[model samples]
Target: MPSDKFDVLVIGAGLAGLRCARVLAAAGRDVQVWEAADEVGGRIRTRAIDGFLCDRGFQVLNPAYPELKRAIDISDLRLQPFGAGVAVRRQSGSAVWVHPLREPARVPSMLAHGGVRPAGVLALLRWSLPALRPRALKSSQRQDRSLREGLDRQGVRGELRRVIDQFLAGVVLDDTGATSNAFALLLARVFLLGVPALPSDGMRSLPRQLAAPLGDRIVLQRSALHVESDADGWQVHSPDGVVHATHVVVATDPAAAAALTDVATPPAHGVVTDWWATDQMPPGPAMLWIDSRTDKPGPVINTAVISAAAPTYAPRGHHLIAATALLAPTATPPPEDATRQHAADILGADGRSWTLLTRDVIPEALPAQLPPLRVRQSVRLAAGLWCCGDHRDTASIQGALVSGRRTGEAILRSPARI
Candidate 1:
């Protein structure tokens, strides 16, 4: 027996779920959103603690997402741009590749420091060109392979290999050997062309902005336990009540999505982010810092004095610094002291004066996107059941938003539903 009825019952209030419901409801279809958490935004959230804003992870928005412009207003986010290029920190020295453009002013400094090289400069530009080409997006008819193999084919070795692997490990949150070549190329295509921006309100605002118009349509703190298809449509079991609907959408994390659809879910990677507050800002352009040196302390990858990139993250007189390290499946993360030390070494900041904030460990942070990647997945799971999520598509914000939009459109396209 069911308590309420709707044309579509959406489970999970994450980016995908919200986007799906937004389309369905806009089309005059009866849509209801159920979220287990007290608030929406799922993995993309912002928390206010001690007068500081901490995002779920070090996240920036990509406006080049084909659907983003249609989904939400970019101006409302009040984006903050990252510096022209990233600062690569190595054991011997550090250098900025200046991804934005070559400047006459920077040439003298680069040459004087002896940090920039002709070979490395050539390698960076050479690989970036492929991202702009059409073939980068096309899936190969050949055998699937890892990013390491792809780099080898491009004749990338030594410094270039190490640099790409470390930078990408921060992006994919997985080791290079476990990452897919096709996926890596696609990522390169997305990033090389896209401008990264952080919302002034916070990362959570992106989803919150999406969920805003659907006032009464959303039900929070209602954990949907199971989904059972009936002769008529579908019954979603929840502790609050079972809702009957013609279409059921499961937009939860990989484990929950796997349980509902019986679809095999990919392995997830755990990431540890350590936060530190300091009145003293690190000296540098507002840019991301990555370790270009050999690994010494655990799997430290990148650190950002995020406040320098986006001032809204910190209080009026203070700043926020986040240091991220990827964890192996069965490996324990390094202690906070060691982690702070590692971050200081990479950031060239005084760790002793900084105060430690909370440390967050998201076990299922990102789904492992290995070889043979599909940019999109079929939304129609059954006659009345559907699915959409980062796991179904690319493990990314754009993929999640696109998947939700596709599911919504697919449902509307079904003749019986209309």
Candidate 2:
């Protein structure tokens, strides 16, 4: 390969970059992907610590994502599934609220135990059923509202509302319910359609699967410092050397992408995830637990026995648990003591003996899915330059793949100036 020339140069090796390059390369385009990290997967990476597989943050792969289905074969992931619904932790005890379609048997028990209310169920249906329709799912077609206002208008209240709010806080990394209601409904539709799960290795498996075919096309430890357009095409400056290409795709994270392209920086949602190892596993099926105490919610938004969901995440006899807290912009992460105590309270376990594996504080975990959600944001910045990532779409694995594929398709359809 030439040291500083290519048909196309991609600036990041995340899902978006890899998927974009894959599409272009498959079409016989000379594409080379440059990733600053030593490995691929970007934010979705997994770390091996003392025989434990720890993902950078709490993440799962939803087979229901349309783009994901088209990009990679799901069977290869060896997915370990989580239960249909969450375990709501109250002062007295915890109750599991599952979807009737996924786990009908649990519905009866849930009702008999006063875990669910008919009004809340009806309200939830009213708010979420429209998401199933093609037209309503399109953000551009409907009247948009903040999640908090939308829930209020739809009558999703009381304990059910609390559970939904808390659970979604972890999902979107925002506890304030300021995210777009339409986006939340779309997210709910996917969860209803498919159970999110972890691969045998970790969330990193998703990116690794996408990167496998590209092989040598991906250049690791290579970061593009600046990008400039020339008469021929574009030039990407890096610490290593300058690379000139007929076209360039800035597929890095939102912050990095903003720096290298004309794209405006989007607001980011932060999250703090703590992984704990314990000899005694929490007794429960593989499901998320959210605090629903009538008094007051704790610092932790959600906690789960990760090992129960994917045993491969832990060593032979030990178990892995994860507790996640939403971080406000410029706010320090909740103290370790608070999160640990909240985890214990929510799980009804004594985590005093548990070992703290690691704490991951990602201030830019995901782009904020704010109100008036804009789906399919433009990828074509100029004739020969493009950008693609979750920020350009729905802020998810699905969005990243879709945006990348969109850029690749758009580029393929246009005539090359060079």
Q: Which one wins on lDDT?
A: 2
lDDT of 1 by residue, 1-418 (tens): 2348778888899999999999998998888898999999989988887878888866778777767888999889998877756777866757775554424467557645636566665765665565665354555626557877777766676655777888788888986467877777777776666657789988998999999999988989998888898876988888877778889998888798888887678898888888889999887667778777765554577888888889998999899988888877787887888878888777777888888777878888998887776677787788889988888888888889988999999989875542
141-173: candidate 2 lDDT, tens digit per residue: 358889999899999988889899988888899
- TM-scores, all candidates, are 0.93, 0.97
Clashes of each: 0, 0
lDDT of 1 at 250: 89
List of clashing residue pairs for candidate 2: none
Error of 2 at 146 (Å): 0.6
Residue-pair clashes, model 1: 0
Point out where model 2 deviates above 4 Å. Answer: 139-142
